[model samples]
Target: MRSIYLRITQPVIKLMLALTWSLASLQAAQAGETPIPVEKFFKSAQFKDAQLSPNAELIAFLAADNDNRSMLVIMNSKGDATPTVITRYSNLDVIFFHWVNNERLVYGISEKDLGAGEKNSGSGLFAIDKDGKNSRQLIDRFVKAGAPKFRLLPARTRFISTTGNESSDDIYVGQNSTERMNAGINLFRLNTRTGQTEIVAVPPHSIDFLFDPSGQVRIATASKNGITSVHYKENKNTEWVQLYQFDDTVEDGYSPVFIGTSGQFYVTARNGKDTAALYQYDTKSKSLIPNPLLALNGFDFDGDILFDNQQNKLAGIRYETDAHASVWFDEKDKKIQSQIDALLPNMVNLVDKGRSQDANVRLVKSFSDTHPGNYSLFNVDTSKLTQLGVVNPDIDPAKMAYRDSVRYKARDGLEIPAYITLPKGRPAKNLPLIVMVHGGPFLRGGHWNWTPAVQFLASRGYAVIEPDFRGSTGYGKKLHQAGWKQWGLAMQDDLADAREWAIKQGYADPKRVCIAGASYGGYAVLMGLIKEPDLYRCGISWVGVSDINLLYDVSWSDTAGNAWTKYGMPKLIGDQQKDAEQLQRTSPLQQASRLKNPLILAYGGADVRVPLIHGTKFYDAVKAHNSKVEWIVYPEEAHGWGLLKNNVDFWTRVEKFLDENTAVK
Candidate 1:
């Protein structure tokens, strides 16, 4: 490739950056009718996350400042138009925060690291008053370049609970144990006012902790091999009792532990059913109730049990299948939910309880399969839903593509669930398809909402297919279990199934179809080409696992080579000794010689999960045999592209690649 002036020349590159940023700003579709620019989708949301204060008198939201840095803004219920920029960071992204009370809030900052291992995100906790006054750094996570080494707590070291009133200055914080991997987690009551922390409770070394709304440590999960020990306690004074030990070898492990609002232990386990369903455990007797609290018809109930903190009542159980739905337990709240649903029948209305004493003003976020999200302040007193502001104001709901949940049976007669997205105002028939697989094969695959990736592909006049496949969680234990130890085998088959289904439905042009994904999905992309060589016309794999053995080899990487992966990989993925032959066959690097399709392979330099080694090793191997593979790398990126410029650059390459290969048939 010739050195392009826009990329190689420093002066021209600076000029291009100025030109690109300028073009990004001047876009507004009359009716979402014009093809939305790639930058529009990649641009940071005007408001990332917003929350109403305890009193509902004020709203706290995260928005980019003048320098494109994340900041917290405080405003009245009318919206943060003339808002007070309470907190600002030059580099860090204000990812998450919750109001400590009506007057105070604690927030955590994060840099763009989807899989940044050991690159301290400056996630240290901070607290501030409503006026942006008296801001204090409670926990300092930042480190100077040549400063003395100080170990950082877990990225999830977070505020566990707050009283939701101004009276309580102390917020419960969950800190990770610095000593051992087995030391489950420690709890501390940090005074937001005085910047002092009090050790509240410390549980035995385990993987994670389970706490109730009242700031009580109820359950702890410990792991050895694949067997996870669930330990529970009645109260703070009692000794921890063993609830049950589960072996993950069977399926992604049929288990879900959470403290329900009903004052009973809510768990999801396969008691007598094939799929893990909701079950209530008796804390007093230390036994399961043998019956489900709430079980859906087909899908596994995989949502939170709504708890009204102020009123101290169980609101309802919300779950997702084709789309998100809820079953309200509280009659009054149920009626309210029904009325809201009637009002916004096209969109799903997620209701969050208010922090006020009366709990009358509920915060509702309404969104549809096509639309992004709308923040609405629901006034319970007047039963009125007022539109506060949108998440992405540039995205017009009417101009977005149509998304539908579709189900198809795999070769083994197992029902496969997937989501299909079609371009707006375009004929769905004979469309080019991009089989976009989700990264976590164990987690839920596709959500029924406005996903930028899917919508972006759809905007380019291509149909997008995302299959949950077997082994994906939030569906059922059977499907999840079916994916156990099958990595590229059954999982790859599911991808093929999704493609064939789309072709059969007359929605996908078989000749113009391609494969693309990140992480494990990227691994699947490479394997799909290996297994079904003629199926896909092209492959785009970024930050993908090239070898199954790398999962165990890369131990220094935090999430990749950790306590949980060691014990779980043998059962969930594959045993190195037992399934060596299968793993060898599945490894993308080993089968690089088989590559013949036009492929775009990219990786993050600091990607610990799917490290740069995976990309380099595979790239070299492929280059030795067939040098047709186009390769790229984001030096500062961790896992996927998090920065705005990198994302736009990636999609620009993708759009150009698809246009070259999977052009409109």
Candidate 2:
């Protein structure tokens, strides 16, 4: 029932001072029912991420400091020792980090101040002790011109994962060769302190690797010419034998999960079913078990297995349905979960245990549709829960909107899953609506949790609906495959269907709907305006693709050279040459003159995926006829806004735009 404040250093005090000024400015800008400022929704969380030491004695986390830079800090889980500032940088921020062992941790850094266009350095890795000693650079941030030769690993080298054995300092790293995009990675066993590495056995053309609980490479998946071959080895002494192969374009076969201590191989497979389920793999027979280990009714197997290192056994399985949940095979852990739930009955409480069974402290992350989430330490011995930190301290669950999972049938009768977030303190009828499309038309969109962008719109009195249209993943094979080659055609229809569904349900005003998204979702925004101008009064698209053909034609884009463009796009999204007619017909660039809705088009100048050209060309075409169009470009940003200042400015503009176009008279 008590809260423990972690000890802070002088730099963190400066960070608090900076946060005060930033928040003061935000408060000065707030007004009306939506008292929460735009900055509150877009600003980085005070506590970015956290992890417990193997023994659960210490906790390491990334915290944003005074300059809005993410710094690495360590604190005692027992709240007894002074928290140590492990890594501090004025310009760069610690982006990714992990505890290598009980005493040492490793992290990767990036330039937070620079946009993707201006960022020239790579994310180099470094290691330091928990006590803020024995600091060493394991990889070079960038290869400086005429720099002296050094022992540090190349900038291209990346830390994959820590060896499960917390007693040792050795970890696994992967380094790609000169032909990085197309070639397999050279696996290495790296020592943190010594900077020495030994080459590990890797399957030919392997793109991914999986290791057992004992830190032995047991499975490798290799991709070549659209075919994915899974290779497996019983031990380090044995050769990797080819298990099975499947076409990358087709949805078939099983994916390797993790090897159990008992040498049982676990995997996830559809097994001739619509949704994927967890099953044990029969190595000898090269097939999945007849019965699934775990399965969900409507959702696919989209989570990881929890292994208890001390007991050398599978403890539980953590998966996602409408929300994240865990199934514990062990009775004691189940009892612990029940207790945590009883204490935090209103939210979803996820319990994470340290590798050492002797560790009494369990890290709990609890959140709900209205809550952004908070991290806490649950002491088993004292039967007490002490709060560590909240993700967004400024967010109030009382003012935030409620997100509900929904489903509606498309024109062809295929059920499309969606999420609808209704504005707080408002009746679920005749509200202004925003059909917010997700970027990855091929990936899953929303989950049953707190989302900043969605909440921000809802706070402004707009009902937001995110449709996991035909091409989106995570639902089942039917929904995913049905989206192939639909792009601006069927995929665009799904957004309109979602809008119609909301209006029919009396949750939206039929005349007050707007469409908005980024990337592919941005593309959908333009297409929605073009194909169904009467349905939407306005449209907002940022860093969106205007021409489908440009996805293949634009060589400067990072997407140009990848496997997705070469193989996946040709099959799933319409081939460049063979389907040129369809591509041109669906392209927003070709039909821009047809769009007459009030529109806002924003693009990141440094975006490599859907470059600024997509926006500039479409603007030129649409602006010639439509005088209501507003165009803005962030030269420093790429793909999406990275800086908090940019995010605040962009969303504030969005708030004004939505009110001007869709607000009730």
Candidate 3:
């Protein structure tokens, strides 16, 4: 009986493998052909931004209709019951939400109006009960004759302090921004007995906002450009102090970490030595104590100072190092090596357990180099994880290869981290590689998931390498700050270095390397082919910013504001006027003639960030050079390919381009 069962199962598995290979081959041959419903992917049944309800018994997440109209939905804890929409606004999108009580949820809504670049416009507050009842706007917009009156502060703070225990906690909300932009938030107090709402903290900007462990507001953090102060009415005596004041060179306050019991404030700061160390400001002593846990120079880790307010016995601190997780035993003055081992395995198990419950969790659990992010949740108490969902699960896993994270010392002695995914069922030597750079030149990179593009290329048998080069977030501030003035210089070198590292590691062939990315990543791809033409066989850029100067060259009518200057332009890409030559050297358009590699460019017609002009200008320049370039424009799309048809179409063209141009073994 056992032998017969094995015989039957083995044959079935072998047949399935054969069928998968056949489908892959067919898909490859028809790489340029359109398959599946084009509009189906754009339907926005795609769920995003999920938050567990306050009670932890239900989850309130955002869902969308076929038109991409978003609504708030509530599901049971286990996600067993059908999801019910608490909202039905077709033109409105729920940007974010917070659970008010077990029965009601509050959210910020913004209209889906585009083209004007008004991101914050049409934003207002609303309240809805969990059962899809009593949905009403907390505030509404009105157009009056001749003139209008308005304030940034909300009429109430119901959303911030939702847990019914607001009275016991002292609440404050606006303390971060230096200038109060019309008190941009509303504060409200809800009387539980009569359900009457009263005005609480009037906004423009609170000096600071504080919250307790139960997600309750306890204190407000206040600061001024010239003054360092903590304002709290403690023991009936309201006193303020000039904590540690800095020279005018200092900018911004530390994101305050509150110690619940003593209400002490802790912050991480670099002292005279230019090394980061944790400093605790005692509420009673009014003195600052340097924490020993983070005494190491040139290195920093986020130490969660968990405290059991009831016991006051510092509940131990946990932190992660370069490759290992560590925990600090406060009282013992030593780190718990065993505790780190215990925590990771449990976390892993929780993740593994979650896969069985939610498809999201399961997807994340099965994340590979070729895939994108999968979602899973692990419960600390139960030591179990629930898989919530997975994206693009229809793609067969066997047709893809898993990537391993690798770290290599760059020429500058910087430890660069990257992930290289080999083609499925292919030998390691002489494989074509797509050196993919991540967007956010300032953000983090390549996490586990089912990457349609990566898998699609791997299916055509091209190894893909994604490097989270220097400037990536989640590593530390030092690494991020390093890429400040080195946009096209070091950043471009990092991409090139990845190819060399891969070649040295015996994972890739130097002759058939291609560079690919979208947005900032797209720009990286263009830079790769231009700056290191000999290293790349081809390149792909989708909605990439080509001209650095043109990024800020916009019409007055555009509401994007001076975001480049306001957000990161000063520290990241450099001021346009000051670094004119550097920006010109880095601009892809300036070096378009040097791009010898075959190129594929895709852009959204409505992409205001990079704009259609970016692609058009680059294409025109490439044409002027009489270069071999392929270009495609999606008329209805915005910054990204919202329609699934476009995504599949672009990939199909990409597969054909890579296959025809390069030798993929």
Output the worst ten-in-a-row residue range by lDDT, candidate 3.
1-10
lDDT by residue (601-637, candidate 2, tens digit) is 9999988888888988999999989999989999999
Residue 601 accuracy (lDDT) in model 2: 95
Q: Candidate 2: where is the Cα deviation over 4 Å?
A: 1-31, 145-148
**Per-residue accuracy of model 1 over 1-665 as CA lDDT, tens digit each:** 01101111111001111122222222332134456788888777766677878667888888877776778988787443677888887767787788887789988887753335436555777889998888776766654555432332334466676743456777877766664344455777778878666776544566566766655667777775556777777777878888777666644333545674345677776666665666677767767776677665556767777666666655567666567767776677788887887777668788876555356666788887667888777777778887766878888766677677767899999888788887766556898999998997788878778888888888878899999988887666678888988888888998998999999999999999999999999999999887787999999999998998987887656555455566777778898998899999899889988988888999988877678998999998888766658899988788888777788899989999989987644
Q: Candidates' lDDT values, in order?
A: 0.75, 0.83, 0.58
What TM-score does prediction 2 earn? Answer: 0.93
Worst 10 residues of 2 by lDDT: 9-18
The C-alpha TM-scores of every prediction are 0.88, 0.93, 0.69
Instruction: Name the lDDT value of residue 192 in candidate 3.
Output: 30
Please give, for residues 1-665, the per-residue lDDT of candidate 3 as tens digits.
Answer: 00000011111101122223455545553564333332322233345556554345677677666676677888776646777887867777776776666667667776553422333344555667788777665543332344322323343222455433322222222212323321233445543322345554422334454454444444444333333344332321344333444321234234445545345565555544333455565556655554433443333434455444444444444332222222333432222223222442312111211101222221113233333323544443353545555434444444456655566676797877676777655456778889898887776675443456666666666788888787775445556666777777888888888989988878788888889999888999888888878889899899898977777665421223433343456457777788888889999999888887789999887676778888999998897665578989987677777555677688778878887778744
Better of 2 and 3 by TM-score: 2
- Between candidates 1 and 3, the one scoring higher on TM-score is 1
lDDT of 2 at 359: 77
